[model samples]
Target: MKDFDLVIRNGTIVTSSDIFSGDIGIKRGEIKELGRNLSERAEDVYDAKGKYIFPGGIDAHTHLDMPFGGTFSSDDFNTGTKAAAIGGTTTIVDFAVQPQGKTLNETIEMWREKADGNACIDYGLHLAITQMNDKTREEIPQVIRDGYSSFKVFMIYEGMMVDDLTFMEVLDIASENNGLISVHAENPFVIDYFTKKLLESGKTAPKYHEISRPAYCEGEATNRAISLAKMTNAPLYVVHCSCEESASEIKKAREEGFPIMGETCPQYLLLSRDNYEEEGFNGAKYVMSPPLRDKKNWNYLWKALNDGVLQTVATDHCPFFMKQKRMGLDDFTKIPNGAPGIELRMALMYSYGVDKGNISIEKFVQLTSTNVAKIFGLYPKKGSIVVGGDADLMIFDPEKKVKISKDILHENVDYTPYEELELKGYPVATFSRGELIAEDGEYIGSENRGEFIKRSGPKII
Candidate 1:
């Protein structure tokens, strides 16, 4: 019999802390040992020559088959998770929306049922609060106890936005329950008024989409959300933050020692408002909430990430086909408020951030995997490669080049906003729980391999 279950030999191991050349030995589904040439034999061995082995990516934000506008996103749990695995991600935390008037438990159960047998990697849920009341606020402690420690409260979306009173109440309860609150920071009322005026003036094209939801709307909401978090003494995470104004708001709060965090997506860092001005209805493909800002804001976002104002990078991978995007041809407000991005998030960030000298490789690991795991309470068990940690790893090839095209991606969406963009660096192999799920640009995992990760209480460290 082999002394070890498997051995990954002679690779540069990169973690959030350090980089070293060594071999990782696995037993069952956990990392049994990591060092140079251990005195052990294995049933299988992989020669990882000239590659970087890192912990599998954990995408903190994604939307699978989310219902928006008049149609649902094309990719469900199975296809989306498959795309994630191929891209070197082994875990995802998707939103479980509590529709207006529905109980949080019911919404969670519905989302759980949807992902039961369709996922290909480990998964978790973030509850989206659509309606906040005394009962909903009271349920925070129970939900926290039930292992959903993070909740998303929107500042935009007409039917879903919460008022100041409701927001304060929810924050108070979350604080008491040791939970973190993520805000979709955009002023819905301001956008609503502007949208009506723009449409009334015959500005119905996709270009008008960005014009309706200006940066100031996002800035104002960011400031308000930060104030609410301060008032309640609760930790806050601003999702998909765009523009310098919003980053400044978060920075100011952090400087004051508030527990405020920020996350930005690949779209805001790579794509810009120019994409919304494409000819005809093509611009609709890039239309998402708090739409991409001008080129100048990209530098500010990088600064925020470098300065520790922004803590995580996520995909917000919501999708709609080109045909579905046209649902709002006569009214930009009717278009779905999302874009397809699961497969391209990590590559785009690695190419632009790390390759361009904007961030260090260690920082990349933190923003992409470690911080996410820590915030959601998955820490050493799921985000690191130390002894006794889960053996979820990826073999990264820095020399590999890829050109973006929706036709080749696993997402069911019809078009991708980054279609012609070329990227360097890609993941050649991905493993989840010691099982090889993707290799050589192909996915090999079967459905239902994913298990729900129920969060425990707050971190003791």
Candidate 2:
């Protein structure tokens, strides 16, 4: 009998904490051993000379197949998860929105129907609570017990925004029941006031999207959310934080011993408000919630990531075709609010953040993979490469260079926001549970192999 199902030889193993030159042995979809040399037989062997072996990425924020702005996101689970694998992410926790009159159970079933036989990689769901009633209240604990351990509440948006009372109740119940709450930290009133003023003044351009939603909108709501989390003694995760004002608030709250964490995306850290100035209706492609901020906020977010103030980096991967984005041609408000980055997160972090000296390689791993898994309760199983952990791995080529464009990606979208961005490092191969699903940006995986992960409570690391 073979000593292992497969053995990867001669790679530099890297985790959030350490790096060493060794080999990884895999059997039965789990890591069986980690050591230098094994002369024992194996069914397959991969020589990964001069490569870096790191745990597969876990994107904690994504909107695959989700509905927003009157249309469905273009990248459904079938394409989205495969694109994520090509980019080195093996798992994703996507939001399942509860409609105005739907129960949490019904919402989960709807999302399950969308992903059941489509996904090519593992995934989990976070319920986006749109209504709060006595029945919903009673179901919260049961949902947590059933392994749906994180809930989402929107602080903005017209129909999805929860009142302060509902937010407080959700926080209280989530904290009491060991679930965590994530919020879209932007004040709706502020957005409404500025947007109405801009449109009334004949400023209905894509540039006005950023003007209507200023940095302070995010700042004010982030502060309020942190205060609410403190009052309820619960952990709060601020998603897609885009400005220095919000980062400062999160930093101060964390320093004061609050269980507050924030996530920032590459568009916020690399792209800027200037993207909204692309000629004509072309600028609609860059329109997203908490619109990209001034370039000055970039370094501040990078510093926050390095200093532990911002603990995670996620791609709010909600893609839409250019035709869908053009619905706002006459009015910017009709533009869909998202961009595609699920296939670019790893390369961007590796090239810009690590190679550019903004963050260390270990810090890169923590921000992109390890910290995400820990906060979402998949720590040792999904984030690390220790013995007995899932064989989710990425073999990276530190010196390889790639020029990114929509044509080169697997996401089911018409445009790429990071078009023409050059990168010095990229994933050469990706493995999910011992299966080589993607190699060199080409997918080799089967559909519906993904299992819905039943996660435990938030680990708070």
Best by TM-score: 2
lDDT of 2 by residue, 70-91 (tens): 9989999999999999999999
- Clash pairs, candidate 1, are none
Cα lDDT tens digits, model 1, 1-461, are: 76678888888999988999999998888999998785357788887889889898999899997877657888899989999998889999999888878889888889998898899999989888888767786788898888898888888776677888888878888878888788999888788888899989999998888999899999999999999989888888899998897989999998888888889988999889999878888889988988988999999999899888998899999998888888898988888889888887777878888888998888888888888888888888888888999999989888888888877687778888889888888888998988999997789976679999887544421
lDDT of each: 0.86, 0.91
**C-alpha TM-scores of all predictions:** 0.97, 0.99
Candidate 2 clashing pairs, residues 3+ apart or interchain = none
Report lDDT (Cα) of residue 431, candidate 1.
87
Question: Which candidate tops lDDT?
Answer: 2
Q: After superposition, which runs of candidate 2 have C-alpha atoms over 4 Å from their true positions? A: none
